[model samples]
Target: MNVGEWAGLVAAAGSILGGGGWFVSRATRDAARATAAATEAAARANAAPAQQQASLAVLEATVKRVDEENGSLRGKMSRLEAVLRAFAWTTDRWSQQMHRAGIEPEPPHPLVEEYNRTGV
Candidate 1:
């Protein structure tokens, strides 16, 4: 071939090779991105069970603490009820003694009367 024809052939070959290289580079980059995404998804899948277990542990601990507090509150309520019973009994006795002595006792509050009636 002549020199000009040779040059043109060289240019055409270079253009084809360059375009193919660009496409190859783009394909490589896309494949790398897909691989990274798959790896990240796999890591998240592996961690999910551990994360759920952690949440379950937290919930169990909270339930145990609440149960303990409930027991403590039940004890406190029992003591309070005993105190109220004693107070009601004392007041009744006092009122009886005052009536026997011909002294008019002050009327009890409505709430106090209600508790005495209900024994609650």
Candidate 2:
């Protein structure tokens, strides 16, 4: 081949190789960026469920604690109510006994009579 034709062919080949290299480099860079974004998104997606589960666990624990406290308070109230009933029964018996012994039994208070009437 002539020197001029050979030189022209070499130049054309160099230009094509340079363009192809530039395109390949750009494609590789774009692919790498996309992969990185996907990895970050996947990490966030995986973390979301764990975060929700942790929050739910905390809420469940709080509910259980509140239920336990409510039950304890109810038990204490039941015992208090029983004691009050026993005291009222004993006081009523004592009043009746005093009346039978010739002692002047005081008249019941208006509030007491009202409560007794209502059975409250």
Candidate 3:
């Protein structure tokens, strides 16, 4: 072949080699990205159970705390009810004794009348 033909052949061969190298490089990058994504997905999958256990533990602790608060509230309510019962008995006895002694008892205020009508 002449020199010009030889040069053209060399240029063509170089372009083919470069195109093949570019394709290989692109394929390698895509494969690497896919591998990294799969690895991240696997890690997340492995951690899911532990994350669920942690959430469950938090829920259990909250339930236990609410149960304890309810127990304390119940005790407080029981004490208040006992005090109210004692007060009612004392007031009834005092009024009866005052009436027997011929002394009139003071009338209840309007607010006290409403409380007596309503449970409040």
Measured with C-alpha atoms, the lDDT of residue 6 in candidate 3 is 100
Count residue pairs with overlapping backbones in model 3. 0
| Model 3 lDDT tens row, 44-111 | 99999999999999999999999999999999999997887687668768989999999999986776
Q: Sort the predicted structures by lDDT, highest score first.
A: 1, 2, 3
- lDDT tens readout by residue for model 2, 1-120: 999999999999999999999999999999999999999999999999999999999999999999999999999999997887787788799998998998977888887777667756
Two-way TM-score contest, 1 vs 2, winner: 1
Once model 3 is optimally superposed onto the true structure by TM-score, how far is the C-alpha of residue 80 displaced, in angstroms? Answer: 1.0
lDDT of 1 by residue, 1-120 (tens): 999999999999999999999999999999999999999999999999999999999999999999999999999999999988888889899999999999999999999988878865
Instruction: List candidate 2 segments past 4 Å from native.
Output: 1-44, 107-111
Off by over 4 Å in 3: 99-106, 109-111
Report the number of the highest-lDDT candidate: 1
TM-score to native of every candidate shown = 0.82, 0.55, 0.79
TM-score of 3: 0.79
lDDT value, candidate 2, whole model = 0.92
